[model samples]
Target: MENRGAKPENVEIGLGKESFGVTNLQDHNIHTEPELGLDIMRHSAAHLLAAAVLELWPDAKFGIGPTIRDGFYYDFDLSFSLTPDLLEQIEKKMKELQKQRLPYEQSEVPIDEAIALMEEAGQSYKTELLHDLKTKGTTAVVKGLDDPNVFKTGMETVTLYRLGNFVDLCRGPHMEHSAQTGFFKLTSVSGAYWRGDEKNKQLQRIYGTSFETKADLKEYLARKEEAKKRDHRCLGEELKIFTFSEEIGAGLPLWLPNGTIIRHELEKLAMEEERKDGYQRVATPHLTKADLYYRSGHLPYYREDMYEPINIEGQEYFLKPMNCPHHHHIYSAEPRSYRDLPVRLAEYGTVYRFEQSGSLNGILRTRGFVQNDAHIYCTEDQAKDEFLRVMQLHERFYRLFGIKNFYMRLSLPDMDRLNKFVDDSESWTKALKIIKAAMEESGLPYVEAAGEAAFYGPKVDFQIESVMGTEYTMSTNQLDFLAAKRFNLEYVGSDGQKHPVYVIHRAPLGSHERFIAFLLEHYAGKMPVWLAPEQVSIIPIAERNYEYAKKIHDLLFSADVPTAFGGVRVQVNHSNESMQKRIRAATMKKIPYMLVVGDREQESGSVSVRTRSGVDLKSMPVEAFLERITKELKTRQDLPVE
Candidate 1:
């Protein structure tokens, strides 16, 4: 048992290391304390749920029950489809079990005895799990690892959690007893394939939320409701930002005109920032030879996520999955001295990955997207300064976007998994020191995650909070000391000898698709004026003033206030609809400016300017209106909105 509060103390009980048991709980130390001991409470509630399900369906084979952000879920193999009424019954049963004050008893059972107990209880899944563990060293060639609970590791003993009449295969540091699980709700039930493989049998997955107190749960539920209202998928379509087509493909989005405008503006802004920081822009092909990836050491580590190779001219080519390899080739394509030591290359490069269909979420997760990718090559001494600069750049980005809630995560390597990476002890130590010094120098609040680093290097992942209070990774900065040697890229040092350059890989905006999706939800479709699809919507009071509206549109369009989609995002609503209706339409579209031209204003060579927030700025001269908009666009200021 652990302390029951937010940010728990020593909740994780590690069995051992250097040949650790491969259960999900084994790694829970990294994620043990989450928001007021909620993880422990939710985790305990999962056991309560399992106990409840087993009571109703005696033969139900239970699967893993992991605690999620707001709640937890447990998969069960049952005889019938689940319904809401049955969920209520399960919740009711769980409440009854809680009244019994059951204690979760952890026991170490011998492997053979564990298998015999599961087999006798008709838990075929558990038996298969142990059987796989016993044959883990035999290379039995599993058709597919289709069970999330199945860890094919031959542990000396199986740790089981017993709660009343129900026994589950679990590595538990659960609550002391059932009272800790009092405030919980069984949220929903859905069918999920075992282990997320479509070919595997579908199991009923029950989802629920648990908090230490009812007030906390209520606040969380309210946030959940708000999240639904601000979901990017809904906001995107309603605001004409982006849409999907089944005929086009899954995990691939065809950016709508409005969405294209936002992306173009973002690219333009990022380019300007990078240019100011001495970054040279370059473009690379969408496809490259597979040999390049093999040389870059990406094939062995990332081949599963990469698209299959394309056969061209009897050579295997692949869709470029990452930009670093190509950038490294660029660095090696020329000869240089220490003067070019701090070479920075940037691009809005498009990359492809074969994301599983189920894992894809609108624009947030897609197969094809463009990244604000950059690579910096500098001397070993300049590496820390460059890393600090990257961190400063990240802070600049967040400030510009009004993102106040975020922290950096320093991802370090796991010594136990050294074989999976390029294991140069000296290089790893040097790189870790450089990054750690930079982090300390930068004086930024950060957290550390072990075993989260890339195969090539450690990295800093920028986790930004969405408007809904959800923290998500918005950017990543990595320190790579091996890519230079791997690509044979070298620059002559001041000592007049060839030296391996330090590589710093960064993506401040992450990707065009995901960032735009985030902005949509973050601003609630009230995009900043510079990045809004349509900066101004011209609405005439009646048909008689349509000509004046057209003239105003022409003038603004002619000014061409730096918009995406290759043109000014100005529209003249010449329809016969009432001016109020047209204004309403423009407001709903999240247009930053609505210029309503009527007879008197048209004759006065002026127009009534109304902001998207419904503030009427009365009538102003056409020149002054244009200047106001031009200044807003130039400064890229976020205007106040409704």
Candidate 2:
């Protein structure tokens, strides 16, 4: 750890669930290798930031300062408004503190003393936190606090971290002194509700990131700049993929023709794959009786995410938050026998959730989204096989999307919270064993996470890393022994007895909205031929070539190319624009291929083609070019360029 330079933000101590504790780096064997090391430095930098902010504003009320994928943010309620100038000033203060070599001294003080000190410092938030700690009986293992996950351990303690004159109530595994945090910059600031509740006062959140070396920070910023250029929200507008309107309502995306075409293609691909896997297509109503959710045990556990019930006549109903409950009802709708034991049902179900407004991020986090959801009801003996099949489906989707960096996060139930989890000891043990065995056999890299599982069963969440190394938890599958038991879904086994069936819930693509966003960033909006809204844009070099361009467009429209909006997306630039300008416009739209027609090409019965990357393919006969692209589009080839 010293070789990596200085102390880690926190140490992983033993907890019934996932937890970390603050301690000197020398106390335990800490591995700050690469990614983990970067995270530690960034989190530690957050402490440095709070310290800096404290110097600027003596009345600043501190909030959580957790590290995100690429940066960290700390919320502070201050007397004066924050500005770009203020951020630069804070950075200077941080640098001064860094030079002072203030050790991140961790101490455990009596709850009374801690509260008094916080009150004296005029930090109501810290005082309130201390009061909560007192009520919760601050009995942590009494060590350094570092990781943000440490807070969730539910331990009440006053771990005071003092650096120079600025002190904060935190879990310290910060740096031995401030300088070890390395190079850091204050990126930006935004209004964040204290504790993330809208009703709470809005606190200004200062965001920043840190790296061990200036070069590393430069490289990270370059990738970040690249990511901004490929951001789906921007590309979506430029390519006319999707749009939003205040009149249409928030988070409800209005898909244009191009976006609709791409969506249908993705849906077509998933449908065909599931069909080959013997999944029967099924559809459920957008709304369902509230009793159905109660029966499936979603009413209490999932109530917060779900919208308040709609009063349909005298009974209350709900827009479905998930498709599994409806599928469970479907399973119980008919009498099942052993021969029909392993029934696979699939749907491209659209579900709704009352997501917090601040948490929404383009299509990635939306109020309404479509899920590639499916459920399988099978005997206990068949559970592993079905789960493995689901994993394979997930792998296939990742391959199709050209996502190579990914692993499974096996979310296991927290044993201590039996009430939150199903209280079936035998079932829990058997289900977990089955999931683990299947994962081990799959030969995929995976890690187990305690307390991340659905209340019903353990889940396998697929975490995908984009080309830029940003990770997203985009897909998942979970075994459901509890839902089956709750819904009383059973099958007539060969033993001539009605036995409760095991259920497997799987979503390979997650949601079209979110998946498309991932694809946009993954491909940088240059989707492959199959997924591109406009597969080809036909451009006429002059007015003489218009007739030939239309003919080529007709040929494509007649072929297997997708049709949306009106007819096929065989865009013909009929406007009197320069050839270069037209070509550039087509390239900007990210059309997979552009067909350039001129007098010579028309006379030769050929078309010159250029890929979205502007590489010329010279001239080829119209038939030959059609054959090449149609085959590529139909097969959904993972192309080298877009």
Candidate 3:
């Protein structure tokens, strides 16, 4: 062991103690422990990936390689295209070097020296980045400063990592040695722009994942396979529920007839529940003047998430990205008395948010979505009660969907990081206290997170992890005292004086697009009977039983069960296909039940009931089958079928 040159005196290891205001790193307990420390190892593995690429292809140029949530990726510019077979070659070289356990050595170089080295290597992208840093006010790296031997007019000292003669400029807290990166696999290769700017040249990006043990890697791969089977995009297409077209643009889903049926059912359920909860249904325009956003502070802070304003007769208008401001205007439409202190306004509002193209994944992340949105206008004394009611509503709905593995997230602001939160500190504190109290009274398990609150208030977000081990925000209940003040919303108090009102913004179902997509995966496309697009299917054993099948279809259709008849193509089982083939077709469509009719069943005045799980209920009265389905539909039960 050579000891790696006395550990390089100016290592600069560990998070900045002063910036985080922590005198002792151990006290905060925020050090990169085993899991995150292993991530650093994987990041070093990414560098190894790039090093192998450069060794194999001498002219290859580097872009960036960073560890993501569960994996790492590196972008490269190569003379030849990369394929799966090529990735194996790269992996072979990486393992060869890993076996050597090469030391990752760091070195500081002068500005001109670094530039000349990269230029000779034809790394023009790095040169351009260096020049951009110089244009900014960075004076740490200079052209020719001799005494301190440091770059005085560019990015602070450029750090380079060298492993067995392969060098890369990086800001590293890498693994101590290459051998630490274990149980790694190269997953895929795709094209990406340099630094995510579309105008930049496209580079080939290689994605890989690493774990501390082989078992972890195997578990990750198994979860990935499970997620693939549950992907809503594939399920939606197979079930003929939704489709996307290039002509309709990306992120806009075109719902087929079956999909629309599901959407309408969800809307109906929400509307009924909200009406019972004393909510007043209202509708708002999809677009509003830009001045409206200015009044709500959205124009200045949230404009990036909104589409660019449209100019009309010297006035700017924008498609609404949220429904709160519009609902605020509706609340202010007339003078309010103390009796109307807790007015609940609800809407299935459609909104448009500008999501990055790379972020869009079917309906889960879309440009346009409809939120099951509502806002409660209440007095300060009613804030806690209102929040509690919202939480109860959320729990009730989750129970309906059999979602039990979720918890509350109390999102509060970082008082020390003022820029990360709204300027009104007192209001934020009050809102945070009220939400915390509500969560406690509701008796729900919750975890607090700093810097996760909304700009207008503190919030309690409901989070659920998907089958793929990815966390998603299911719904949110936010308390706001600032929005009321900003919009000048006030009501007469008991003393007959006008006082600012409090607001609670809630979305129990979040966005319809995202929730449906989650349910599609969570249930593996086997939707609950009530939510199933095609609840029942009618099949005739032969063409001779066609009349009986049509009668059964009409009867079920009249009973409000979604049923359709399978025609001659599905009826004729004489060809290569068997009865199992027909049943498999219905199962693949996720039809909750199938009614198989033949002369025997027709003469007996009963139907052969077959459930989605391949259970053959020999012969049951049509009335009995309808009764069971009706009960399940009305109660919205997650029934265990035979």
Q: Using lDDT as the measure, which candidate wins?
A: 1
Task: For residues 431-527, write the lDDT of model 2, one tens digit per residue.
Answer: 8899998898888889877655544566676777778666666776778787666778999989989999998888888788888887888899988
Question: 163 in model 1: Cα distance from truth in Å?
Answer: 10
**Could you give the candidate ranking by lDDT, starting with the highest?**
1, 2, 3
Residue lDDT tens for model 3, 1-642: 000011011111111222122111211211113367867988999988887887788888888788976789998988779988999999998898888888899888865677777788888877765555545423233443453533344454476788775677776889877888888889899999886778889999999989889998998888878888988889889877788999998999998987877777788778878888889999999989998887776676567667988888999999988898889999999999889878999998998877788767888778888889999999988889989989988888888887776678775555776444345777778878888889999997788776544456666667765545445566767787877777889998889999999988888888788888878887888887787887777777777777887777766666764223211111222333455677787898888787787899889878888888787777898888878787776677845765
**lDDT scores for all predictions?**
0.79, 0.77, 0.74
Check candidate 2 and list the clashing pairs: 22-144, 22-145, 138-156, 145-171, 145-172
Rate residue 350 of model 1 by lDDT.
Answer: 91
In order of TM-score, best first, we have 3, 1, 2
| Residue 307 accuracy (lDDT) in model 1 | 93
* Backbone collision tally, model 1: 3
Determine which window of 10 residues in candidate 1 has minimal summed lDDT.
3-12
Could you tell me which 10 consecutive residues in candidate 2 have the lowest summed lDDT?
4-13
Q: Residue by residue across 137-178, what tens digits does model 1's lDDT show?
A: 221345545655455566657788899888987767799888
